[model samples]
Target: MIDIQYSAEVRAAKNDGTPIVALESTIITHGMPYPQNIEVAAQVEQDIRDAGAVPATIAVIDGRLRVGLEPDQLKDLGQAQGVAKISRADMAACIASGGTGATTVAATMIAAHFAGIEVFATGGIGGVHRGAETSFDISADLHELAQTPVTVVAAGAKAILDLAKTLEVLETLGVPVIAHGQDEFPAFWSAKSPFATPLRMDTAEQIAKAHATRRALGLPGGQLVANPIPLADQIPSEELDPIIASAQQDAEAHRITGKAVTPYLLQRIYERTEGRSLIANIALVRNNARLAAGIAKALKAQAG
Candidate 1:
């Protein structure tokens, strides 16, 4: 078995049987520049704690899988340069090669499962990118959710993705996409999208029960809780629609493909929105963290 390092807090939570929520580290290393990334990470962790669960931010450091990061480690990672943004395909290679890396949603799910964590919180998941018919770009996150039995809470797939296609692909994969408290599927920065949700769940307890029921039935996959961003923080989808289109055009014009596509589009959106996108991102992540914590607690209660 591969060795996993646990931060002192996580070690304590494990020993005490406290509910824990897993977090991805790419948001720290790849989401934004230093200091601010660390600050947002700290805030999200605190939100989980305030909502009555511990947070385990997963990443790979110097080839070792770290299930939870200490304060110093988080700070260093935020400042580190050229860290690999790893997913299912590259995570193992990063570890085996003794390289430091930040985990994406898929990689975080794998690590969370290895560490026996059942819930995760993130801003938004990558999904069917626009123009994927030609690019064949689909996120490994969708596939991970189809097999890994951890509950993931997010606003929804990133707004830049083709939301309808993302939902269709999830249905095909047999993954449950449960929209929290609404009939409409949420856009990443906006509370509602044009598409209706495949499933709607109102309470964390209901979501937790669904998760347990899936496990009881020997289901091989996990559930996605589409928690919407708070109304005050949202950037209306109507406003973002045109911005996204423009960004995509820029991407096509610049020939930004594959992994570069997301960051480039996000930067363009960020520039166009004058930083409102980042603010909304931070808000939604914290909101997801709170809800994920509640689900973790509910699951713990169900187990007992």
Candidate 2:
């Protein structure tokens, strides 16, 4: 009934019981410009393959849920205009209407679970907005993690979000926020945040075991693997804080509200930072892909 279609590689991987990592499509359709978006997406997919797992970039094309995209499909998605940012709430509607859309973190997790994939790689997860208490503008991604059963690997919540509130919400939802190889939680473009992670994991095997243990204990939700951006590529918290503040102010000045806020802020930051933020974003995404692949491989090995 889901009407899901898989790429040849994804289908083969599924049939063979091989490791496969789920990737969200927003990074292509909404995160960056065309050509570069497609190129970076392809590179991330290739990173998973190089690490011994298949990549399934989830999206809805013409109302059908696609587990993996072909090269042409990826290109089209990158170039398409006015693509809907589909989350759990809108994914079904998009499919029902036969619409073309890109999956966000929440939608990607749902699709991955439906496809029996356990690990997802992304640049970062959405979280509590800076003024969420008053605006009630929290992302559905938080609640999605509370119920979904897929492990998510990312640099961390976007720097533009209220990291403290995001971590608090995750804690309340009983989701494990495991920082990979560090005690401090990452802040997307920055390698570290001021807050400490609830849990720390040193290796992919440990993170994989934590995921398996959660399932064994009948835990209701997935785990957040907060892998930090490589130190070399990081912009540092001190440098990014002021830049983020300026971008946030710009968004408020422009009256950008709701979903428009994130893209507006990111675009402003990208310009303010002279494209360094985008470079760091692409690097972190590749880093996440590599880690997710390892975690997927470990999960498969454990199953066997």
Best by lDDT: 1
TM-score per candidate: 0.99, 0.99
Compose the digit string of candidate 1's lDDT tens values, residues 7-39: 999999999999999999999999998889999
The TM-score that candidate 2 achieves is 0.99
Q: Which digits, one per residue and each the tens of the lDDT, describe model 2 over residues 179-243? A: 99999999999999999998999999999999999999998889999999999999999998999
Model 1 Cα displacement at 274 (Å)? 0.8
Native-to-model Cα distance after best TM-score fit, residue 29 in candidate 2, in Å: 0.5
Candidate 2, poorest ten consecutive residues by summed lDDT: 27-36
